[model samples]
Target: MADDRRKNRIFRGSLGLLLLSLVLSGGCWDRRELETLAVVTGMGLNYAAQGDGYEVAFQIVRAAQLQSASGGAGGGGELKPVWILRSTGPTVFEAVRNATFQSSRRLFLSHNQVLIISEAVAKGGLLPALEFFVRDHEPRNTQWLLLTPDEPVEILDAAAGLERVSALAIVDLMKQYQLTSKIKPVYLADYIKTRIEKTTANTLPIIRIYETAGKKELLLDGTAILKEDRLVGFLDHKETRGLLWVLGEVRGGVITVDLPGGGKATFEIFDAIPKVKVEFKEGRVQVKIEIKERAGLGAQTTYADLSTPEQFKKLENLQTKAIEDEIRAALAKAKAYKADIFGFGEYLYKHDHRTWQRLQKEWERYFVDAQVEIKIEAMVEELGLVTRPATYRELRK
Candidate 1:
């Protein structure tokens, strides 16, 4: 009987301990409730009006409103699915912490998708304003980075349209670069890596606010050129495409060329391959770029039929000249700014470190005067559905 009672007591104590361990293990130690978080989806940075500090905008997602929108109620009564909070301080970190004074929930930034910097901030020097995002563990390196000539806050306020959150819409807009290949999307990691390099410059796409029927929308305006960390200049849409072509980032776009007779012909680029060769002659750096593209006939505004081999070769020549002109335009803009957005300096460092070392101190001067040759070979493989114009007399007959 004594042995039986002792065994029962031991079993009871073991059972209790096991149950307690399970309960403790099941509870989350670092859990934060969803209601206590103001999740930041996008951030905008600008120089403060006083010109002594920073103005920051945080686009926070409203969980309740998001849920309501997805349920087909359109946010359950007039409250948008996002909340914009603006704050100012001497530094970005302080500005972020200051947001808690007006916000009910703690700010959470791990979900951030994009960062927009104003021209003032970028021109003044981006490194000072960008330190926080780089050091903070909350923001990811994959976040899309953009520049705006107007107020950065305006970009965050644009309508989402297809997306429930405006920030997500901005992300989707960056993804569309593959469609037109007119602008290259610079992510946070790409900028950081380029900025930290010894001789490489960086570039960011420009975002502008467009108003249609009183509704403001986001539009990609041009390319922002950054020599080191400061904004030096900008490239227009045509120039941006030229830069993209050299970077091998052009996926698809229409290249229009003037026809021999009259009017214009547009070629839909199906494939583009860019090759760059750097050579040194008598200590002079020379960059030779060859761009080969395959395109299909998109449209011919001219009445002349271009189905014959002779006519096709003429059309190809025109397209080649047009491509070379775009490349030259980009090169001229970069030279005017004295910015090596083409990574020529980095190329030299990798291929010939000794030469790069000699020119590293005055790379801008060399880059401005660097000898560049652009060669283009555009082949129109397919002529679309019909070889002749739809309005041609033979087709009509």
Candidate 2:
């Protein structure tokens, strides 16, 4: 009876220990509650005016204000949906951690949508200021990367027309880039890939503030060209689209051309495909860019019936010339900068490794003097509901 009693006591002790272990390991030890985190929607990087350190800006969405804006229980006027928190340090990692001094909750960056880099920082070098975002676990790699001549913090603080958060609004702008095909959207991962490439250069969309009639707004204006991780020059909207054309990223946009007789015709670009061939002849590098494009007659002020074969053929020719002109303009600017934003060097590396190996050392010099030929085949596939200009038809009647 005494031995049985001792066995029962040992079994009971083992059961108690097992229950305790289960209770201790049931939940995550490092789990944080939602209310303890400050959700960051946007981040901006700029140079600190006082020292050689960096300034980081975090746009934190105010949850209560956002709820109120969405018809939650709020009696008074709407409050600003985001709080712009700024901090500075000698390094980006330190700068990010310093934000905790001003913020009550831990800053969470998983939801960050956009990263704005100042012109000053971009001109100096992007890698130094961008190392933290690239290496950090919290910040996502898919966030849109933008460059701004204006203050990045100010850009984040600017008003968002539809979205309560300016970062998300900027995301929307990037999504609609296909509609215009004039802006190039670069993600953090994409930027990193370009930065690591030996022959290829990088470009980021330029965002700035526009004010009129006592109201301020954000607009994507142009493209910032980066060579060797430093800003070399910029491409205006027209030239930007030209770059997009060579990259075959043009989805939908309008092309307006003047007619030989009078007025102008607008063609809505339905699709565009580009074929680039890099040839090495007699130790000389040449690039041939051929573009195949399909468009429709969106609007015309000319009296000619563009639906007919003769008139349509002329229209096609004009469209082709216009596209070629854009491509040439972009090529001229890129060569002037001696920046290979077209990935010609990358193409050589992939297709002709031996040639790339020979020219890899002085690729920039070769690129500056390289011969580029452009050919465009544009077809106007649709003429819309009417054959000719409505006004012209009425006048004929």
Candidate 3:
């Protein structure tokens, strides 16, 4: 037994040594030089008006220009952010191959951060248009998906930032703003799943790039509402926040409430908890949304005293009312657009498939008319600094 064990150990050690030797001698597989690889930071899909098929645009990052572009250089010396390459074909794969007409090395998309779909291409049905992305093995699944009113190719070219181009800026925005803003970061996988599981309802963050207001910036505001993978309408910034509140994704944002007279006191929502309850009566379904929140004093333009517990309670009530107002407004707009971005339809489908089938055909209709009761309950913990005697110094006196 001892002899056999020694032999087995020797064989294992020898095999490990051989593998290490092979790895050390081997070279990188499918390795390409940085200059050879055209870094694809963003992809745009648009409709070819000529009826040729789909229009695909690649945002090729220019490293040479970007390297020394930020050294207090004027616009002339600044780097060209993206070299636009266009192709049209029956499918994304074919279009990608066609893009080689203007390139050399294989176009790499794994590092891509955003995918923009034009209104025309998305209206045709985003699922089929994006099937290539979902089914193909190129694009990252976590890529941020966006919808633009103009051709997506425009956004890819509208690189405007001191540090990085639009694509890199977008990648940073998604990472940072999520912690402090209620904008739901739209990912490619989430959007596709949202369409498949529910009544074809989802939202994509909207981005627009234009040399307007004396500045060129890639602005992402509100959300593009989609019903069955088609553009129906859009939500304003506040409406987007409300949608996030419904989705239980509210983290931190400022909520301003009007006081009794004319002053407006704003509170920063430091924490938020959304409670949604679904009930079924006979064959009908009802939803109750309870948005509970805790906030701190962000602004106090009102002369109202917030030192007392009663004063804090009043402020909490005021904030709650403001939150409810925004929620109602967002819900009304969503219903009018016939877009179920709140995923209420999805919840119904998951819990009760039978009722969902009955409601699927007219889910939008029911959603528009369905009685959704909303209740907001908020509390104020701290008023920034002094909450004991600042409001009424006379009490201390």
Candidate 4:
């Protein structure tokens, strides 16, 4: 009888321990349901016109509406897939927290893909506005950082073309920058990295809203040049590509040059490799950029047979001149602004530390007066499917 009582006690103890284990092993004690959170895909910062605070805009996805749209629900009463909310505070952190007062659910930012800053905020300085994002644990560093002249909220609210959300559309645009190589896409991390450098400046693609056919459209225009943390000037598309060439970021794009025979030919870039050398000579900084590029004949406006050896050589010369001109233009702009966007100062610092140290304090003066030489070797490898223009045979006939 005593043995049976001991067995019963042991069984009760085991059962209690099992129940406790079950309770403790259940995870997600503080997990919030998806319906209780607002998913923010894009965040924009701008200076408040009425006050000395920041105006923060968020592009929140309407989960249910997006689902219904993807599910092929055809109803005229369907709602939009995103909502743009604006909030204001004395600082970015406070502005973010202030959003909770307007939003019923917490604003979630882990899914954010783009961060747009207005020209006003960017011109004032990015460190003050970007501190919150850099210090926060939730915002990712991979998000594309863009500058805009228009209202940040307006850009966020612009139509997204095929995309349901404008922010995602902006992300797609950034990914396809290699197609034109005219805009340099800068991420939050990239900006931060350049900012940490003492002499290297930074660049960010410019995003703007334009009206086309009575519809608002988003466009990635030129580029914003920032010296240190403040916006200094801008670069046009051609100038931006020139900057890309020096940075060895040109992958795929088209270069059109006028032929000596009074027609134009467009060459699609297959490969381009830039070799840059920064030297201190004659008590001045000299930068030499040699770009070796290979391209194929994409299209021609003339009926001349460009496939011939003589004509191909001429095309290559023209292509080389075109590239050199672009680089020179970009260099001129950079020197005018006294901005070392090409990181020549950093190059000197790494290769010749003593020279960099002596000039680091007055690097801007050295950079403005720096002598730059550009050399381009362009090759026309392919002539596409047809040797001559399609109308060449007809013209010969």
What lDDT tens digits, residue by residue, belong to model 2 across residues 47-128? 9989899999999999989888788676777668999999999998899899999999989988999999999999999988
Please say which candidate is ahead in lDDT: 1 or 4. 4
Q: What TM-score against the true fold does each predicted structure earn?
A: 0.91, 0.94, 0.86, 0.93
> In angstroms, how far off is 133's CA in candidate 3?
1.3
In candidate 1, the residue pairs with backbone N, CA or C atoms under 3 Å apart (3 or more residues apart, or in different chains) clash, namely none
Q: Which ten residues in a row have the lowest lDDT in candidate 1?
A: 388-397
Better of 1 and 4 by TM-score: 4
Which lDDT value does model 2 have at 24? Answer: 91
- RMSD values for the candidates in order, in angstroms, are 3.1, 2.4, 5.5, 2.7
**Model 3 weakest lDDT span, ten residues long:** 388-397
What ranking emerges by TM-score with the best candidate at the front? 2, 4, 1, 3
State the C-alpha lDDT per candidate: 0.88, 0.92, 0.80, 0.91
Q: Give the lowest summed-lDDT range of ten residues in model 2.
A: 388-397
Candidate 2's C-alpha lDDT? 0.92
Evaluate model 1: give its TM-score.
0.91
Off by over 4 Å in 2: 1-28, 72-74, 391-397
Model 4, global lDDT = 0.91
Give the Cα-based TM-score of candidate 2 against the true structure: 0.94
| Candidate 4 structure quality by residue, lDDT tens digits, 1-397 | 9999999999999999999999988986656789999999999999877879999999999999999988998599887899889999999889888999999999988888999999999999998998888898889999999999999899899998889899999999999988988999998999999899889888989999999988789999999899989999999999999999899999999998988758789999988999999999999999999999999999999877789899888889999999988888888999888899999999999899999999999999999989998888999999889998666264444
What is the per-residue lDDT of model 1 for residues 1-397, given as tens digits with 9 covering 90 to 100?
9999999999999999999999989986656888889999999999888858999999999888888767887633569888999999999999999999999987888889999999988988898998898899778888999999888888898886678787899899899787778888999889988998887778999988889888888888889999879998999988998898898989998989998767999989997999987766776779999999988889988778888788888888998998888889999999999888888888888888888888989888888879998999989888888978766364454
By TM-score, is 2 or 3 better?
Answer: 2
Best model number under TM-score: 2
Candidate 4 structure, TM-score to reference: 0.93
